[model samples]
Target: MQFDRKGLSDEDLLRFYLAILKPRMIEEKMLVLLRQGRISKWFSGIGQEAISVGAALALQPDEWVMPLHRNLGIFTTRGMPLHKLFQQWQGQKEGYSKGRERSFHFGSGEHHICGMISHLGPQLSIADGVALAHKLRREDKVSLSFTGDGGTSEGDFHEALNVSAVWDLPVIFIIENNGYGLSTPVSEQYRCESLVQRAKGYGMEGVCIDGNNLLTVYDTIKGVREYCIREQKPYLIECMTFRMRGHEEASGTKYVPPELFVQWAEKDPVKKFEEWLLLEGVLTYSHMEQVKASMKAEIESELVRAELGGPIVPVTTEELEDVYAPVPEVGTDKDIETVRQFSTSRPIRFIDAIKEGLKSGMEEHSNLVLMGQDIADYGGAFKITEGFVELFGKERVRNTPLCESAILGAALGLSLEGFKSMVEMQFADFVSVGLNQIVNNLAKIHYRWGQHADVVVRLPTGAGVGAGPFHSQSNEAWFVHTPGLKIVYPSTPEDAKGLLLASLADPNPVLFFEHKALYRSISGEVPEAYYTIPIGKARIVQEGSDLSIITYGAAVHWAKEYADQHPELSIDIVDLRSLLPLDYDAIRASVTRTGKVIVLHEDTLTGGIGGEISAWIGEHCFELLDAPVLRCASLDTPVPFNLELEKNFLAKSRLATTVDRLLRY
Candidate 1:
């Protein structure tokens, strides 16, 4: 019943025992709170405490731990105040997340821990980024990420492993193979003999161990830490264990077999570890009693303090806060003019302008890294980053695999590790591959944890001649609908460069849509230096009083051409640069002056940015309007491969006709 101390002192062993008991005591109290309806549901890590505590103990103070919802022992081991943990459960403003996120979805920058998200697999890739940042900075600190057996089935798991292996990042991916991923068992999750064996495919070392054995868990992590640091590579440790309690407080044990629970009860990590300590004479009977009493008293004290603190009152103004970081004014008009004067002033393609902006950003900020599929060697699908790898080197301009989820997830991690990342989706249509990470992880991280996820996703969008459906599509509407995301679809070369620079500077998740059709077609003078156009500001491309055309990206060029042909109609063109924070002031000024409006876009007619603009005008500017609002966009069907059909699908003729109809109305 005794465990070898190995190199750990008596105090270290006692500290480990305390780590396991603290979370158990806290979880038991929280379960009571849940039953009383004073708190929300609780995810109890009753049996799996040893794994969290042991691994946390093995890591250095500066090392980061991206814990899952069940790893409450990690917080206890890291010296997080017990009252803050209870305050978070009570939804108090004093907690780590300031009552924004209840439960375990919180992280502390001060403690070098990442806040957990419900989707478990994405954290692996984020941990990889953190590890990568440590490697880039020449720091020996490692990142430990935890996930369950069910999470391994997620695409992010494979993506994280692959990227970490390929880059040789100092990350330890710990898979707590708890018998079930909720109701589904490991047998149903994967057909493999063991999850650890899968790590070989990624060319990394893997191991399986008895997770409940606290000494084995601690020793293994200690060795793994040394190996990862010495070799500068990722390691996967599959800790075989069981989730003794129900998935959550609301979940019943009806799905679990009584005999299986009885079997696991015998192997209860806390009981096993306590008996070992008693038998080894590390603790006498009185000592054990004192330890239990101390933990109980501590929990009671924290609970009282948390109850007295009360819950945060919901405020209308607080809800609007922390949407995006305040945009920093980099320079004045005179500084911008000076930048323009110093550089070679020449006309460049829209795509080239974007490349210049990226170059300027990298030159200015060493922390900025570029990542995408074929961006390094192939220069991307469109040659945007052709000479980037040679200029910035492979370390900064990385060539990632076709794993979009990891690309975004890792970008978030890099951002958290004090680096700004610009991620490129090979094409706009392919962004759907990583939509979960983009919508859930990237966009919501800043809002949830008050952390800056400074990531800019450059998407090549829109269809013109014959690029078919998959390669070409305007998907800006999908992101615009998502809160906490800034959408920028620039129409001109100057705006493309300026807006991209601005997106890079902003400390929020920005989806920068580069119109593929306008990459080569649009050519204009662009500033050579880093001059950012303010995000959420719409540019008035043309001035008129007859009618207004609110459009962006490729449609802006079409609107300009149409306006030129029709001299009788004094059309005002409002090119919306940023979609999320829509420029209502400029939009209202143009719409009120014209009294008739036509909303245009390249996305599908049904459910597009055009619809949002039309609805807002109808609601707010209805009295100012002389006629009804009209919209001109692509057909609901997919983009056709044929040149003629594609042109007809997003025809300038259709837009011109819509403008005429709106003007006549």
Candidate 2:
């Protein structure tokens, strides 16, 4: 049988080998750099050089590559300088992995290298998302994410691959079968004979190749890339490579069969590629030697240049300072400024405001969609989406399965597809179920990639009603602790409408905390025309220099009621619209002016949002405070079923009492 291959030009083949060989050498040098304390840590793509180089060279410059830690050759082929790559390991400012990223984490905004995560399996899912985005945007770009055979064990790997196949997304999942996953061998990792066979489950074409052969790697990936463009199909490339080194420089492969390492090393990619290039007249022996010398010299030069660039300025304690976004202009317009007037102008309830905001946002931007348990025809538990189905149709306002992970995960997919998703957690307490999807996945998506996951998570929080602990509990503190998540808790209808609209427009992932107690009871005016209060901004419900009443959600009203009664003890009120990006500026400024402070929240006093606010005030305005940051929170007990008992157990009117006590302080 004769096989006809549209082979590469001799010049191209030589260039490819030379390009790869240098990075392989750099990989070796990086190990030494690691040991010498010049570099932090290293995940050398030693035996898998050909696979990395080939896939990188085969893809178009505009096409995206989401590589793992063990794919330095891919980085090098895509013009990531050795010094910068080294500087990354050395924890230098010049390193391409941005100062914020870990040593193994790498990629470039300029090169279209969409983030390389150290964690296994999820890269392919993100790459699939990026590919989906490309398709929607009508951009001719393919997204490739590399992983090891071990990563195939992860559920996300299969989920992402099947989704890609179903959507006909242009993604190439490269499995560098390097024999072992840390201490575990492939035999232990999977029962399957080869990783490529797994693709059959997803109904996609799969290929296995000699990963050590640079020519094979290049031709295979190039063929797949061409086929993907022509067929508009996803692919699974299983490169049967070896791992000459352990997972990282810190670990040694002592447990590996010595003979296995010896056997694979004999088939070293650099030498194999050189031999094939020479056999095909692609390069002269002298040319091979020159390439090696050039690579060595180039790497050496980069090391020196990188060293001269200086060590990374460690992110100081002060630098992690001011973590939140600029205080959103919550009441930017004069009409929206006065809370009492805004409330009286139109008595729209909290649930009504949520429905109105979703309707207005959807009407304003076709990209917005609402999803959650019973949010479609059932109109949510609070009947927030009562008329949404009739107005927006089933497609825009959809119901989801009970799987919190699945619901949040699908929202992630939809958001990546450029649809702004407003996902609601049935209750604030149930948010714990989907917390991983919210914090680990969605929150960090933007910071991880230079892209944004514009999403709004509407969580019904607070505990004054007799719903009990299981259903009636505030969990805002859980999210405010997470940096990338934006937490917004509005006290009234106008703020709810404005903040929800603002959250829809904001680039970051927002957690809109709606108090279940306030849903029907709390009513305020909403504007006829569409308007948005900026996120991270605060509302001074009242102005007084005597004492500062800092609170959010249902507690805002309690503070206001108390302030009205005691006209002598002046109280300055700050209603934090957003928690994660808390209005620290407003809090600091209010404390500075009033000289007295009281932090109040509905959750338990043990570790509620009040502690965070108090600590922040102590950090920023401690000297100005006449009294210690006074906190008013619910007793550290589960909310009871009795309405009166629940009210006493939670921090409903506690803010009013705390204000009275603080007046004496």
Candidate 3:
């Protein structure tokens, strides 16, 4: 097991040779299958086998690695069963993702491997999370991820590098700079002389190595692994290699200069390594041919077994019968009364309630860590985590760089390690930068592979007080359409604290939207003891029989104000606490009683969540309604900074008029 300074032991040398042969033979057989129409696609790592094989052999079994599309060598070398891998590629039900996803998009906790998204750069941030978790656990383990020459241009790559470097996380970012990203040459990707030069910008160490040489890659990764564990920091390794084939089999190599292929052909990793082994007396031509034949037979047998896997079974439920995790609703009134007897109640602001709920979760579950920009000393952009360091310490209440995607990726890694994370976005609009991580990684992770991302993204959202388009926009509707995310927008302090507890309890990712305007403007009696409001439940702020005003977030108060002013018209106010798994039963009951409804929200009219509600009302509650269902929302325009323009854009008068019109009808 010991690695020698002078050379690898004869056994290790042979083992490495076998490791390289497996993926090489497997891919060769796969290409034939692809040509035969038995397989769908292939990302050939034909010439660059040394990078994945050497990296896998260098890493300890317990250390994690996020493999790229061409890195099947890492999976095969890590002892992942060839049969299951084939089934996965065939889109069979028995595969890791159960046919929900394709190729290397699925990960295995059993093999100490995390999957990569189609967006290659996000894996770098996910690797940061796994490394961060290992560091926090005091485990001397290094987590590594791979990207290509083209992926370095992505902001995720830079964000991940800066985060790992600044936080002193143990990670190795290996760049497979294989000449071209698809058809574009290295010259077109960036102006830097070499990708390794980027390490200096993030204040990290960098090195470039000859990737075609197996022993060189093995030795370099092994050395870097040791260095990262010893120094507790990130390192960049750019494996200078060439892509021998086209990016994928479907994409031909016509764009590549023929001379480049001729040049790289002489440096083929497998054949060259085999030649070296023959010269060193470690292998003979006869033995090499025999071993290769055996490998081919092994792959053939596994392919047959994989072909036996059945098609994806049909499911009647939504999103494969288990896309979203089950989040409990509020307890019955009797149960609620019992819970209230155990806790002291006091008036609290919406902002303070959120802090208390997070603090409570952190206190109860020691594995919970809060991460955001300036959240530690400054307590977050709105001072939500202010003074949290004194209670939870800097390690638990951590300050992150201004990289939302990387932070979200880290949350995924932490979730993998059984740690819950509270990720705070400074403002709601800023979430746009991290949407790839949220929409692709976190949102799809569970549905893709039955792997839960138990993280809460605290979105300080909605508009008021003239914060303008960028600061004040309501973006909850953006994620409501996303299947895997649970959207919670609470309007009151008590609901904010209680719903947060519920969000933390759920296994899936939850988007906890906090309206900035209501943070201090609203005050309510919040329980001192830990209590959870059910995720998919609506609160009836007031009960009436003439009209029902259904809304959530800041608009809940607007409906309450209008209802209080018009005492002549009895109004039923339904505040939707959870948007994704909407409390439709409550809405049905209210609309059936009132026989008329108006969907109100501060956001613009077209494409707003109100439209969805209005449509649902017309479809399901049409017979019970006395008049046509109406939607009261702001004009289809951005939130204005001018005070008077903003007041008119909010559509408060529109709600009042809609109520009177519906009543008259």
lDDT of each: 0.87, 0.76, 0.88
Residues 238-297, model 2: lDDT tens digits: 988888888886788897999998899888888776766677676888877887887788
lDDT of 3: 0.88
TM-score of each: 0.98, 0.82, 0.97
lDDT of 3 by residue, 1-665 (tens): 12223467788888999999999889888889999998798889999999999999999987889888889889999999999999988888888887778788998888888888888999999899989999999989999999999999999999999999989999999999998999999889999899999999999999999988888899999999999999999999999888778899999899999999999889999888888888878888898889988888899999999988667776757454568655445455413355588778899999999999998788877988899989999989999888889998988899998899999999998888889899999999899989999999998887787778989999998776898889888888889999889999999998898889888877789999999999989999888888788788899998899988999998899898887788887889999989988999999999988988888887788888889998898899889988888889887889889988888888674887787788888
TM-score of 2: 0.82
**Which ranges of candidate 2 are over 4 A from the true structure?**
1-5, 153-155, 158-168, 187-210, 213-235, 311-347, 359-455, 464-472, 543-548, 558-572, 588-597, 616-628, 637-648, 653-665
Weakest lDDT window of 10 consecutive positions for candidate 1: 330-339
Error at 650, model 3, angstroms: 0.9
In model 1, what are the clashing residue pairs, if there are any? none
- Arrange candidates, best TM-score first: 1, 3, 2
Model 1 TM-score (2 dp):
0.98
Highest TM-score: which candidate?
1
Q: Which ten residues in a row have the lowest lDDT in candidate 2?
A: 318-327
**Order of all candidates by lDDT, from best down to worst?**
3, 1, 2
